[model samples]
Target: MAGDGTIEKVSIIISKGSLEGVYPGLIMANGARAEGIEANLFFTFFGLDAIHERRWERVRLATVGNPGLHLPTWVGALPGVSALMTRYMARRMDRLDIPPVPEFVEMIADTGAGLYACQASVDLFGYRREDFIGQVKDIITVGEFYDLAAGGQIIFT
Candidate 1:
């Protein structure tokens, strides 16, 4: 906490691949930066897709097993449900002037927030450093993430 009882820094861990999963952390980090708070985003597990060179543009909203959609599991399990929902959400976001995932990532990076990929996840996914977008500061281990996130609030999204 800062002298005014506000957080001085924030470290967000993103572990899911869906649009909903990835965007919250992005928005949080962006908001934190806009508020003059130091922010760092740690990408791990499926969340790596958001920073992946090829997958970022294809990251979709997960409709299946997502109770927030207020739809039955069977309905969400339909072949085209996820795609349809993703398209709908994308249009909604666009109408709100929110950029796409890649552009949003770039925007956040431009704010000087540290963007990192988890080493364990990268190795498990057999992803090379070249596989990540240029905005990634580095692929670091959990220990390194903790070190970098020191004196900051840690949030898992």
Candidate 2:
């Protein structure tokens, strides 16, 4: 390891459908790229929402059970709370100039990062290959994912 202990690459699996879930993975991948490290993202299950052509722009936190919110899940589930929170978060992110999921995905793609979708998720959701963003390189099995991720730190988001 170097003095700062930087890894050469990172493989991230995004498995949540919520905005909160996808943001961390994107942020980490972007950070890794900025540091000149190889970064790859494999979107699976609900995480597929982050790469979904029709839904990526609309993903919001399913605050119903987000323990990090410090409020009763029921309170978050109440009518209108989710929308309000989503709007608030969007404005905050706007202030920071952080692009939305769609644009962020594009930005990462332009940076030479690889984006992948899970084949099992596509089968389970009844989605076709064309349903995801054009940047998706492939819909792969977990074993293939692991093979490509070998020797890299696998971070699950």
Candidate 3:
């Protein structure tokens, strides 16, 4: 609380790698920063792909098993559905003037927000420090994330 029950900071934990999963956290963190709140993004588990050097741009919208698609699971599971949805969403975002993932990450970093990769996940995924994009501040443990998140709200996306 920032002296009147308003949030002053936020720690966003991203655990999903799908395009839909990663963007919410990014948008939230960016919104937090826009509101003058301190924001930190902690990428772990599959979320690691969002910050990965080789995987970020390739992340696809998860149509399969996603009820939000409002389609039968089998339909979503069909070949080319995910890619089509991903392209549609990407075009929509571009129309809305939203930057692509890499540029968005850089934009957020330029605003002084902290971006971190989970150390455990990095090791489990066999990723070196250099495997992340330049915007990632560091690979940190959960405890370290907690430390950075002190006196803030924690949002798991």
Q: Highest TM-score among the candidates is held by which one?
A: 1
Candidate 2: pairs in clash: none
- What CA root-mean-square deviation does each model show from the true structure? 0.8, 1.7, 0.9
Score residue 27 of candidate 1 by CA lDDT. 95
**Clash count for each candidate, listed in order shown:** 0, 0, 0
Using Cα atoms with residue i matched to residue i, what is each candidate's TM-score against the true structure?
Answer: 0.97, 0.94, 0.96
Question: What is the C-alpha lDDT profile of model 1 across 36-130, one tens digit per residue?
Answer: 99999999999999999999999998988898999998999899999999999999999999999999999999999999999999999999999
Sort by TM-score, top down from the best:
1, 3, 2
**Overall lDDT per candidate, in order of appearance:** 0.96, 0.91, 0.93
Candidate 2's C-alpha runs over 4 A off are 1-5
lDDT of 2 by residue, 1-157 (tens): 2458879888999999898999999999999999988999999999999999899989997778888877798999999888888888899999999998899989998898899999999999999999999999999999999998887889998
Error of 3 at 2 (Å): 1.4
| Candidate 1 clash pair list | none
Better lDDT candidate (2, 3):
3
Q: With candidate 1 superimposed using the best TM-score fit, by how many Å does residue 125's alpha carbon deviate from the native?
A: 0.8
Pick by lDDT: 1 or 3, better one = 1
